[model samples]
Structures are given as structure tokens and as C-alpha cells.
Target chain A: MNLHGTPLSIVIFALFVAAVLFLSFFFARKAKSAAGYYAAGGQIHWAVNGISFAGDYLSAASFLGICGMIATLGYDGFLYSIGYLAGWVVALFVVAEPMKRMGKFTFTDALDAKFDSRGIKLAAAISTLVVSICYLIPQMNGAGSLVEPLLGLPHWVGVILVGAIVIVIVSAAGMTSTTYVQFLKGGLLLIFSTILVGFVLSRGLSTEPVGLESGAPRGEMTVQATDSQLLEQGYALLHTTGSLQKYVRDGTTTWWKREADGTLWRAQWTSDGVVNGVAGGVLEPVGRLRQIGGMSEAEAAAGTGSVGPLDFLAHLTHPETRIEQWQKQAVTDEKGAKYAVYTPKMVSGTDQMKPGVKFKVHTTTEKLNFVSLMMALFFGTAALPHILIRYYTVPSPACARKSTIVAIASIGFFYVLTLFMGLGAAVNGTVNPADNNMSAPLLAMSFGGVLFAIISAIAFATVLGTVAGLIVAASGAVAHDLMDRFGRMDLSDRQKVRAGKIAAFAVGIVAIVLGIVFRGVNVSFLVGWAFAVAASANLPAILMLLFWPRTTAAGIVASIIVGIVSSLGIILTGPEMFAGPYGLTAEQAWHPLGQPGIISIPLSFLALIVVSLVTKNRRVAVEA
Target chain B: MLHGPARSSGPDPASGYKTRLGVVMFIIYCVVYAGFVMTNVVNEGRAMQTIVFAGLNLAVVYGFGLIIFALVLALIYNHLCTRKERELNVTRSEKGAGA
Candidate 1:
């Protein structure tokens, strides 16, 4: 879909960017020291930090990517919601309180707290930089996606726009501005989503409006519509699958789509077509929710008038209801020319809600990939460099605990809301084939343009909040951990801040380039790789340092190095990087599973234990 | 009442209980979540997606249940740990005064 910027949405976007810059400058006045710059001088209130935690944690991936996934793929998208919330269980139980009690400036500070080894510092700092940059790329990608639709700017401009804004935001006030920005983004996302869900429930479900009819034969069934009628309908007619071209055909309003073989298929008002060699009544998109399964013809006609939350999910589970599902297929035309087509299929509501729809787990490789993604998400939250650094912004160990709990509550609530929002997008008929990231904002457009503009602005802010945190962690790795601690720079406080700012700018530019390079890949999918890398590299060292009594400094360094190298090795050769971004076929990729966590996580732990045991005698000898 | 801040290391009795409670909660979470994965693998998502409510499947409900379960378990841990810390501190103060 070629999305033109509405004036309201562009203005809202400009105002949001201006507000974020103002916040950076406002917070910059107080960030005079290393503590103030890196950790907000450890003065953040637990409540504020808690919301900020939600802010930092819920990136474009969570808001846009997950919603888009759910909208397009049914229940599979909600799996991320579960896996993401589960990670905080690790953070709260194994990480948060202990992290505050130990570390001062950075995540590396915590990793090297006990050994004070230069090797540990160097390894941890490098892993932090790697994880932060990987995480930064997705946020930038999401930004680029948003800029095209909201401001009508190109994707690269949006990527650069977010990159420049975030560099200034992080380099100016560091954690202080980042935290506040996250707080704002988190709060608004929840509030607006709740409102959107409210609209979904109240409006209930309906098919094509009064102008459209049922059982009008299986050819072209387009109805003449004035611009006022389209506005009255709220959103443009959206199809779940292939692009719908609305025009007159044989004196009737028609929705036509061209096949790869120079043939045009028309979707009539009567849902009848032979899809995938199966003859069935197809679910046509008329910018309204179709009647669900288990609903009697009359009851469905009544449209579940103003349902409660339970009623919404209950209605979706009915076997009788039909859902529009988009399936991607590569087909060769008569000339042997290949094109990727996203064809919409009318799926049983019960089947759409089932597992096989999105994650076809019957295949062994798919099962392993699914489990690997879950593993990464489960362990990754505590290990993420940005998330770990947020723990230090609060004052006491207990505050860290309380904030973790508060964050769990806030984040958990937002995730629950994501299910409804995703479903709302699915039913509201705005799952653009070109950009899944715009689903939530497009769903907002179904309500009104004003709401659409606000949601788009908030979604952009979501990227800003997350990217700023990533830059802070990356810069800290360069300036504090690498330069001052391991590089033996002997830098003053002023010099450290300068080094950090420079690192932030350099990293921001790299992020912009990568974001442009990988434009249409789902942000959440990229974050999955980031999590796998973070868990594999960082979690093993953190857990062992805190738990194993015999953890040697050499063991820690060796394990982190092993974890980082192995995961990156696997990821670079993996299917997603090779076939997805690199334009190679799946069989051409060196590795099968996209996520490395199921392999690399245990490998790191094993490396730590073996290396620690081997160096046990050395530790005793040194003590003597 | 605002319970006092958590103790910062140096061998307080409360740290042991906190660690124990944390381990137990983590283990429970691990088992339940792993069980979720195994069920999906073994049954291949059929058992989980079976409709349990009016038009709501077990998969959706169970996923939601896991999220709420984590929060409730966290609350229980916080409560138990805070109470143990308070009790141990009271006992320590009494011994100190006598000595």
C-alpha cells in the first residue's frame, strides 16, 4: 500500500519529535557527572523507574511488530507476548535486586564486580556493544517503516531522523532523558490501546456496509461509492491477502487483483471462489468484521452487539465464523517468472485460533525454531545491556525489587492489551501486505484520522525510547567499560562523557544504515536474534558469577567469548540472515534454525563450568 | 507502612531466605513454562487449542494464565521475604541489646 501522509498525522509526528528533543535538553542541564550521565545519578523513584522499565522494554517490536504479527497471523503473534513477559520473571528472580546491590555504572560493571579482571571487562563490554547494536537496528527499521506512512518521507529519512534524535537524546542527558521518554511512551501506549480496544468491543462485528450486499454471484461485485460513503465507513476497503484494486467492472463496483500470469481475478460480493484447489465461500474484505463461526445467521446478523472482553475472545473461537488469513507463496507464471504473492484465504475461526495456522509445528525444523525463539525470549530480558543498565538508575536494592515487580505488572497489562489490539487490527481490516508494522496505526485509522495520527506518533516514540536506551548501553561499553577500565585511558569525567557522546553518534549512524538495509523484515524477528545473542553471551556469565562459588575470572571471560563468537557464528550463517535479508534460498543457508539460543545458551553455561573446573586448582594456588 | 529498605549484603540472615524464595519461584516458573513447551511439542498444539470457554481456546487462556501466574508468584515472594527480614532483624536487635 502506498500510504500518503495526512496533514494531521505529519503535524502530530513533528510535534512528537520536538517534544522528545525538548526532554533531552531539559534533562541535560542536570547531567554534569558520570553518574548523572550513565545511571541518572541513581536518584530515579521506583515507580518512575517501573514505568520507565515498561518504556525501555516495550520497543517498536512489542507495539508495532507483535501487533502486526497477530493481525496477519492470528494467535501465533501472541506467543511473543507470553515469551517476553516470561523473561522478566528471570530478571526479577535472578537479576534485579542483586544487580543494584553490585554494579555502579554499566552492565559490564556488574559482570566484572567480583573479579575486577581486565579480560572480563573487555569481553563483557564487547558483548554489550554487540547486543545493543543488534537491538538498535530493529528500532531503526521500525522508525523507517513509520516515517514512510506517517510523514510520507522515505524509509531511510525516517531511519536517519530517529538516529539523529536518539544520538542527541542519549548524548545530552543519558539515562535521565531516556527513562522519562520511555515513561511517556509506555503510559500513552497503554492508554490509547485501551481506548482502541474499547472501540472494537463497542462497534462489535459487521460485514460490508449497507451499500454492499450478499449472494450477488461470483464475478465482480463492486458497488458505486461516493467519497462521503468511504469516509462514513471510516477506512479504505482492506483485503486480508492480495492487493485489492477497486474500480468499475461491467457497470458494477469491483475489487480486482492481477495474478503473476497477466490474468485478473475478481472477488465478487458473494464470497465464492476456488482457493488453493479447494472450492469454498471466500471471506471478502469490506472494511468490517465478518460474521464469526458458531453464530447463528440471525445472531451474526445482529453482530454480537457491544460485547465484553470475554465475549470478544469467545466470539473469535466460534467454529462457524470466518477469518481472512494471508499466506505467502512464491509462484512461477507461464514465462517461468517468479513472484511472491500474499493470497488471502478464508479460514475457519477455530482453525485460525489454532497453532498450525502461523507456526506449522508439524515440521521438526519449525518446532525447533519455535522452541529456540521461546528460549531466547525467556532468558534474554535480564541479559539485555539496556534493560540491565536500567536497574542501576534506581537507588536501593529493594527499590530495584519493587520496581521490577511494578514493571512486571505494567508490562504484563500492556501485553494482554496487545492481544486485543492485534485482533482489532485483524478484524478492522488494515493488515497491509507491504508493511505489517503499520497494523496498529492503521487499525487506529479505522476509528478516525486523528486517532491514527496519535497512534502513529506514539509508535514512533516507542522506537525513540528503545533506541535511546540502546545507545546509552553501547556508549557506556565504549567509554566506561572499554576505554577507562580495560583500555587504561586514564580519562577524566569530562573526557569519559565526551567519549560516550562520540560513541553514541557513531553507533547511531551505523544503526541508520542497517535499518535502511533491512527495511521490511519484522522488527520483532530481529529482536529475537538480539535476545538469542544477549542470552547466549551475557546470561551465562551473569548467572555463574552470582551463583557458582568457584567461578574464576578466566572462566567468565572464556565463557563470554565463546558465547558471543558461537551465537554470532550461528546467526550470520542462519536462515533468517541468509535467506531473509541476504536474498538466498533457504537451502542455500549454512544453518537451519534461525534462533541460536537453544544451541548457544547451554553451550555458554557448559563453557563456564568446564573452564571454571579446569582453572579451579589455579584459583586455590593463587590463594596460597 | 513502608517496610525498611532491603539489606545490602555483608551476611544478613534475610539474604538466605530471599535467595531460597527466589530459587523456588524460578524453579516453579521454569517447570510450568517448560511444561507448556512440551505439551505443544507432544500434542502438537491440539490439546492446548481445544476450546475451553465459549469460543475461547485453551491456548489463549493458558498463555494468559501463565502471565498472571508470574505476577502472583512475585507478590508471594515479596511478601514472604519482607516478613522474614523484619522478623530476623527484630531477633538480632534483641540479642544485641542483651549483649
Candidate 2:
């Protein structure tokens, strides 16, 4: 990616960061009171708030992960868009006006409104922190991922950079700054992605794919040997009947075979090309076609091994092969250098769809489950804490509602465009085989240098907008919910704002560290966990408190705690976490692979009802 | 009659109409959802898969029937609360008149 020190991109990014900071500081001056800092004094126009909603809601996962998944995996990615949009129905029809009427500062305030219970406040606050942090991890991870390819920096550097920038943005103005940044990013991300999509369609598909070397298979390849010496030295021995040939040393192989000229020859295969018809049977050039039987018309036209232009939509909508070829080697040496290997069955398509091949989404009933999961991700956006907080910045509840509607329109349209952009990347032939996250950026490169630079920069901005909003939400939980509500710090407005700034910095640091730790996990899947947790921990409490008259303060507290703990427990014990990080086997894992919503959400609701029923008459007394 | 805050006395007539409208709309949503679910379950043959997929799509896109349910529940609650408010207001006015 070698994007290091691109003076123009650096200048552009720096200016953008500075502009956001300046806006924050400007808002800071107006944020003289806790209400102003926390809720933008509830005076912002609906249009601005709504666009900011789009900005805050479309996190790195939405832009990078979903787009990348769609590019690589097809229609499954669009399922995320559908799920995300549907979640807004819940937000608009259920949560909006009631939330505005109930809470003054944070989501916690709303839950504890009727009960006035410190226990409820503490529990809700804790849930907010946990969900916020869980959601923040993927955002931070996306930031780090973007930084490397965009600015040519190390992954950790990218993580730290986003963390620092977000803290400053949050500390400077609070919701006000966070709102505008989201507004800017949300608008820019859509516009730029639209532009990128246009470029993709205009470029169209070429009959002859570009950037591929002639005489190589459509997919990547590897070699295996059964001897330690061959394994250590990276050589393979080819045997036919009674004849034997060894390919070894200095990136060249020697093999004997009949040539196309009908002459026997020994040839050496070099990294650049094959020298055939003499020694090792004339290293014949491998054309960009692999013999796969019974391919569809769309598949054939796209390319022998890659997706084509006209069939872009077809490839996206239909199932295709996902091949992962690995060489197995046996080493007998003490240092484990030498090995013998053979090309075991190269797993491709339906074979790769088997469990344990790759992530479950690429290969199981989990694929449809994955679609439902992504739906949760997409719909979960409008209901998020950081997103809802932005509504308070708007002037009236009507504006909040209107802005949300606007957000829906804009976000909805952008998600539609993601389908095209993702398909374009899938067939573009410029994709980094290992990193699907780079699909959009790499697709941009296929067009020209300028488009690539611009898209990459906008992707960077996408991370910034999302991270800033998340940091604000986290800081609010700490300073407003914890410090004031729980700690009972009767601090002045200025002191509270200062405390929030400090909290932002601390949370930002934690985010950066976690981002570095979970480096290679799919951002989209991680996002699913966040949504599951949010739905379980926050959604149940908020929904019940607003609608259920019998919902006691104890119920809210119990629901929040139970929701947070159970969801976290399910996630920690689920296959992805247990097998991957905790070093446990899949079967030994406590729950099924990923569907926590199916269980934890119900449990949270049950806990709230049971607890409330038990303590229906016991109301908390408030001191005057 | 017991005295109370005027705003909390009872439901306005206008509010009652709104509540009825909300309930109607909610019923429409539920009916539509039920139809989709039934069609999905009953249909067979090759077209059955398509129908089932559509049903799944509906469930995913509308959010598992919860949004409609929430709206209906909220409307009912609002209707009850508004009635309570109006009644309280009327009771207070009657008490004052008697005094």
C-alpha cells in the first residue's frame, strides 16, 4: 500500500482534523452548562441533527466492513443494510419521543426517570459503558485498519492516531462537536461513495482482465512436500509413474515433461516465467484460466478465475466459490525446517463452505444466519446511544423525528450504492487477496490514482466521524452518569465538562489498546456482538421503562445488569470468542456460535419483569 | 369529587380518536405480518422457497414484529393516560364548584 508520507493526503487529513477540532472549540464556548455540553442545549435544527445521525450511525463497520463483505461475499452483505435500516423503525416509532421526554443527560437518565432509584441509575450506567466499549472496539479496529492503507502507517500507529484525535474532538465540544463531525463525514462518505460507484460503472468490465500475469491460475497456489529438507528449503518433488523430478532452490524448479511441440524436455520454472522444451519439459506459460467444470455464463464472462463486469450484479446476488489453498508440510528436523508434502485436495467453492474452512459466514447455515446478523447490525444503528444522543442537539422533538427521517433517506440511498461499489470491487481484479477490507480502496486504484486517493481519504474520515461520536458517548457515561449521578459530585458545569474531557482521553486510550489486541478478527462480526449486546443490555431496559407501567425501578436495574452480563457471557463463551481467543474447542464452547440475541434479549426482558413484580410496592425514597 | 392537577385529570376527546387510529393501524400491520408468515408456512414446491425467503425478508426488514407491537402498546398506554388526566382535571373542577 506504501501510502506513506503522501504530502497531499497528509495535508488534507490534517486540515480535516483541525477543522473538526476548531468546530468543537467553538461549540465549547456555547457549552457553558451541563445541559448544553451533554445535549447541545436541545437547540439544534432537525436537518443538521438528522444528517449527524447518519454520520454517527454509519460507523467503520458500515462503510468498510459491510462494503468489503458485500464485495467479497455477495448478497449477504446487503442483508446487513436491510437489518440496519429496519432497526430505525423501532427507534422512530418506539424510542424517540419517549426518550426525549424522559431523560435529561444520558440513556441512563431515561431508564431511571420514574423510579428515581440509584440502583437503576448505576446499573444502566454500567450497561451503557459496557455496550459503548464493545461497540467502540470495532470502530477503533477499523480506524487502525484504515490508517495503514491510507497513510502507510503501522496498524498500532493508526489505532493510536484515531484514539488521540477522537479524544480531542470529544473533549473540545461534547455532543456539539461530535454532531458536526458526523454530519460532515456522513455527507462526504455518501457523496464520495456515489462518485466511486459512478467510476466503477463507467469503467465497466473489460473482456480481458488487467493486472493478471499470463499463464497463472485464476486463484493463488502453494506447494507441499513430505520431507523435512524439501519443506525447509521450500521445494517440491513431482513424481509420475517411475520418473521423478525435484523443484528446488532460488525460486526455480526442475521438472521433465512433454512439450506442446511434441518433444520431451527438461525445464526450470522461474518466478517470472517458465523455460520449457529443454530441461524439465519446457516450462510452459500458465494462462489465466483454471479448469473448473460446469461454470455459469456469468462466471465464465467475468473471468476464468475472477468476476467480470457485466455479471457484476449476478456474481453479487448468487453464490460463488471461495477457495483457500494451503500446503501441508512434515518436518523431521529439530528446528522443524525440512518437510515433505503433496498438494492435498485444494478446497474450493462448496468444499470451502464446510465448517472450519474459514469463518462460519462464508460456509454454513450460518450464512443466512449471517444475513440476519448483519440485519441486526444495520438496524441497530438508529437505536445506538451515540446516535440517539445527537437528537438532543436538535431544537424540538419534531426536529428529532424529522432529522431521523432524513437520516433514513440518506442512509438508505447510500446503502443501495454500497451494493454497486462492493460488486465493482469483487470483479475489479485489484483486490488484495488476503485483505478484503481494502476492497473499496483497491477498486478505486483500478480506476486511477486520483480516485484512489480521494476514496481512501474519505474512508479515513468515516472512521473519524464514528470514533468521535463513540468517544462522546463513553465520556458522557463516565462524567455525567457515573461522576454526577453515582459519585454525587456536585461539580459546576465547567468542572463536569472538564471531567468529561478527561474521561474521553482515558476511554480513547483503552480503545486504542483493545484495537491493537483484536487485530485480525472481522470488523463486521465484531460489530454483530456489539449490536447483540446493545439490544440485550440497553434496548430492553429502555423499551420496558417507557412502555411498561408496572416496570419498577428494580426491574430496570435488574434488566440492565442481567442483559449486560448474559450477553457478555454468551459472547465470551460462544464459538468465535471461546475457540479463537480463549483457546477452547468449538464443541466445548458453552453456547452455539453467534446468535446471542436469540437468548440474552429474552432473558433480559424476563429478568426485568420478574424483578419488577417482586418489588412492585417498594419505591425508592428521594431526599429533598 | 377529588381535586387534582388539571392536566392530569382526563383524556381529551381528540386524544381518544388518535388512540383509536393508532390501534387500527397496528392491527393492519399485524394482519399483514400474519398473512406473510402463513403464506410462507403453507406454500410448497419450488415456489415455496421463494415464498419462505420473502417471509424471512419481511421479518428482517420490519424487525421481527416488535416495532408494530411497540406502537400498538404505546398507543393503548397513551389512551389510558390521557383519559386519566382528563378525569382528574374534571374532578378538581367539580370539587371547586361545590366549594
Candidate 3:
């Protein structure tokens, strides 16, 4: 999976980064006032804002994390995609137009729009920074992962590089630069992903170095097809001594080993040469598809040469098709040795297309995790500080609605493409199970080096765009919501812009440190935590402020505080954060599930309602 | 210290229609989405994963169906909301002329 700074990919990545910097400085000339810096003078076209929304939403987690999951874990990965896109529906229908009508700049502007209360502003602003920082961790983590393979640099270098670049991008022109960068990256990601999926369909299925249907019982006799006979009896020896000698017999290398069960197995024969980006002659054609299941009698005889997109799916669901599936388990030997091992099984495509492969749904607690994660995704989109602020960038309420629809279309298309990209990686041998974040880019490499380079570059920009958006939101919370409103700085527009710039740099530095601190975690998994916190803290206030007339400012403030505290508290004490942060075994972690939304989201709403009711009479007394 | 509900705030029909439409669309969306989540909860994904359409499993197709279905609803709501906003503007201009 390590490209090791392949010259072509590195060049492409550098050029793309350079282009992003140029765009930032180019737009810097237009960022004059606080309004222009924070919200692009509220003049962006709905279409541009819509595409930027797609760019911002489709973070490294979307492209890299989901693809890696799909590659390694089949349909379980698509669950994330479905949950993410479903969240957009809430954004478009419930939050978009109303947010535009209400807010001027930061997300707190929307919350404080009616009451103009300092308590509300402080609470919501703090929520913004908390959610933004949690979200920033994943983005920076993605950046670090990309750096090792793409730039041949240390993980910290990648984190610092992206953190510095994003700080400059936000400080230079604020949202204007971030929007254009997102627009460019989003459009490129979609178009390139489509092209990659097209290549997958054109170079259909194959079984190079094929085994006895892949999942034959290890150390047991099974029927393997050889040309000399219709079917020959053989066995698989996964582990052997002497570094395994390779023989070039009949253009296929065979490895021999003595199994404890006393059976002989031969490795599948190889077809020397390259066909449609698949290279042979080498033992591991990492980019070439080595196995597939479910074919007609004649099709099996012919070897599925190439098929259309529909045919690919048809072959996938044929009930006979077996996909290459991998399972990882942590094991301890009788001698007390512990290590994680991966076993690859040829799974039925039907099973691969189902829900319970990676994230199980059998146990009640597991189901709770699934539902909570989905809730976080659903309510989190509208409440995300960066996404809410985008509603302000457009001109009118209708424009906000229109832009959201456009973002939905673009995002939906990309999610569909992720299915193909991930599936293609699964069968094509491009999946790096150790690091799922590398799956999409490595899948691109399986096709061609140029495709790999381009995808990795865009993936880098994907990180930058999302990071800038998050930092801009954080900086806005700091400068406008906290300092200007609550601190009563009463600064001029020019001074406000300067304060925002300085805040952006500081937030960017903090993100770099956190990104370096939390390495090797899946970006998408980290993002789920952010969403849970955002849904818990920010969503109840926004939803009630717009719909419930009796929603007192005290309720909004209390909800924000409770939501942020309880959700974040659960995450920090959860299993995922236990091993490193708390120096405890995951079994010792207190939270039952990693996702806190199922509990925290309802609690926020309850807090808002109860506080509002009790405080309503107090408000009346004040009015008298 | 508080603004009243949309209905109580002088009966602006555009805002009123928007509020109603928002509620209905949200309810419909919740039902459809909750059906997907609850299917997994109830059957643990066994019931919906049956092969129903185009030889694809219901879980796969239904998951995708939810995504595209959301876009279609958004487009429809946008069209209706735009028309209502225009109607409200025209009514206001006519009143201005009469005054």
C-alpha cells in the first residue's frame, strides 16, 4: 500500500497543493471587511455554494474511510454512506432555508437571532469550538495517513503541513477561498471516481492464481481445478517454513508445504502478462482481480473477460459468486503470546451484500451502537457548525434550499461511486487491510500510476477543504461570537477580520497537535464521535428555536451546555478513547457504546423543554 | 424576550405553508428512514434483505432508494416553496399599490 513517494504521485500532489495556495492568495484581494471574510459578503451563487457543500461534506472520511471499509468489510461500509446521505435530508428540508433566513455569520448567529442573549451566544459558541475541534481530529488524522504514502514523510509532517496550509487558506480569504477549493475538489473527486468505476466495469472479473474457491477448509482436502484433470484433490497450507521457495513451472508458481493433517496443496496457476491494467508474472498482482464467484457454465469456461456495469452487479448477486472477504481477530497463543491475525475467506456475494458482516447486529448492545451511530449521522449534519455557516454564504432562503438540493445530488452520486470503488478494491487485491484509509488511493493505483497520483492529490485537497471549513467555524466562534458579542470588544470590521485570522492560526496549530496525538484511528470512526457530540449539543437548540415558540434562551443555553458536556464526556470515557487517553483497558471503559447520540440527543431535547417551561414565568416576571 | 410561533406572528401564509410543509416532509422522511433503522432493529436485517427487485437484495436497494428519494423530495419541496414565496410577494405588492 505504501507508494513510497512514487515520483509521479508526489509531483501531482505537489502541483495540486500549489494550485490551492495560489487560489487562496488570488481571492485574498477581495476579503476586505468582516462580512466578506466570514461569509464571502453573502454573495456566493447558490450553485457554487451547493457544490462547496458537497466538497465540505465529502471529507477524507467519506472518500478514504468509507472506501477502505467497503474494501475490507463489504456492505458494512455502505451503512456509513447511507447514514451520511440520509443526514442531508434533514439539512435540506428542516434546517437550510430557515438557517439562511435567521443567521448572519456564525452558527451562534442563528441560535441568538431572536433573543440576542449573551448566555445563549457563549453556550452555542463554545459548542461550535468543541464540535469543530473534535471534527478537526479526523481530518488531521487523514492528512497524516496520506503523508506517509504520498510524500514519504512522517505522519506528524503531514499533520503540520495540512494544518499550516489550512490556516493560511482560512486567514487569506476566509470562506471565499475555502468554498472555491471545495468546489474544485468536489467536482474533481466525483468526475474521477466515475472514471475509475468505468474502468472497473470494462475489466470485469477474473481468477488469477485462483484457489479452491478461496474459502476451502484450511488443512483439509478439497477439490481444485487443474488443466490436467477436471478436478484435482489438494489442500491449503497458509503458514510454512523456509521463506517458501517459488518455482516458475507452466508460468505459475507453486508453493509446497506439509500440513499437520498430511495433505498436499498447490498454489493457483498464474497467467503471465498484463491485461487492462492488471499485471501478471509477479506472484501478487495487487491490482488484478484474482477471484470471483457466480458465473454461467460457459462463462466460467471462458473466464469473465469484461462486462458492463449492470452485468458486474448481476454477477455479484448471482448467489454463486464468492467475493474475497477478510476477517481480523486478536488471538493469544497457549504460551501467552498475543497478536492480531487476518484470515481471508471467499464469502458468498449474497452474504457480502447484507448488513451484519463488520458491525454486528446480533446482540442488543450492538444494535444500540448501530442506531446511535445512525442518529448521530442523521441529526448531526444540520447542526455541524461548518455546514450551518454555509447557509449564510448564499443570498436568500430559496437559494439556501436550492444549494442544498444541488449538494445532495453531488453527494449522493459520490456515495454510489464509493460502492463500486470499494467493491473493485475488494476483488482487485488493492485493499490494504492494515490501513483502510489507504484503500481508495491504492485502488486507484491498481488501475494506473497516474490515476493513483491524481486521486491521492485530490484526497489531500479533500482534507484541506474540510479542515479550513472547520477552522473558519472555530475562528468565527472565537472572534465574533465570544469576543465581539460576549466580551463586548466592539471592534471595527477590519479588526474583527484580523482577530479571526489570528484565531484561525491558533486553532490550526491545536488541530495539528491533536492529529499527531491520535494516529491510526479510522477518520470516519472519529467523525462519528464528532457527529454524536454535535447532535447532542447543537441540534436540539436549533430545531426548537425555529419551531417552538416557548423555547426560552435559558433553554437553548442549557441544552447547548448539557449536550456538549454529556456527549463529550461519554466519548472521552468510551472504549475507543480508553486505551491511550485514559490508560485503561477498553473493558474498563464506562460507556456501553461509543456513539453517545441515542442517549445524549434525547437528553438535550428534554433539558430544553423542561428548562423552557420552568423559566417561562420568570421571563414574564422580567417583562413586568 | 421571545418571538411567537409562525401562526401567531400576523398569519403570513408563505411562512405558514413553509412551516406546514416542513413538518410533513420531516415526518415522511422520519418514517422512511426509521423504517430502515427499525428493520435492522426488528429483524436484524433478515426481513428487508430479501431479493425483491432487479435481483438485488431489499437492504441494498432500499438503502440506495432512501438516498435518491431524499433528492426527489427536496426538488419537489423547492418548487412548491418557490411558488408560495412568489405568491406572497405579489399579494404584498398589490396591497402596497392600494395604499
List DockQ for all candidates. 0.35, 0.07, 0.37
Q: What lDDT, from 0 to 1, does candidate 1 have?
A: 0.77
Residue-level lDDT of model 2, residues A422-473, one tens digit each, is: 6566555444434556677766665655666777777888888888877878
Q: Give TM-scores for every candidate, taking all chains together and pairing residue i with residue i.
A: 0.87, 0.73, 0.87
Q: Per-residue lDDT for A374 in model 3?
A: 87
Q: Residue by residue across A1-624, what tens digits does model 1's lDDT show?
A: 224678998898888888888988999976777778888878899899998999899999999988888887778888889999999999998888777766877888877776678888899998998888788888898888788878888889999999989988998898889888888888888888889888778767644322122221111222334434543655343232344444432333334354455344443332124332235433333223456666666666666677788888877777777766655555433345343444455667777676666666787888887788789999999899999998888887767888899899999999998888888777766666545667788777767778888999999999999999898999889888888889888888778778878888888888888988877664455677789888998999988888888888888888898898888888889887777768887788886877788899999999988998998875422110
Q: Chain A TM-score of each model, in the order shown? A: 0.87, 0.79, 0.86
Please, what are the lDDT tens digits per residue for candidate 3 over residues A526-576? 688778888999999988887788888899988998898888888778887
How high is the TM-score of chain A in model 3?
Answer: 0.86
Q: Which residue runs does candidate 1 get wrong by more than 4 Å?
A: A209-290, A336-338, A520-524, A620-624, B1-13, B89-99
- State the weakest 10-residue window (summed lDDT) of model 3 chain A: A215-224
- TM for chain B in all models? 0.82, 0.40, 0.82
Q: Which residue window of length 10 is worst by lDDT in model 1 chain A?
A: A211-220
True lDDT of residue A375, candidate 1: 90
Identify the superior model by TM-score, candidate 2 or candidate 3.
3
Candidate 3 residues lying further than 4 Å off, grouped into runs, are: A209-293, A296-303, A332-338, A521-524, A578-586, A620-624, B1-13
Ordering by DockQ:
3, 1, 2
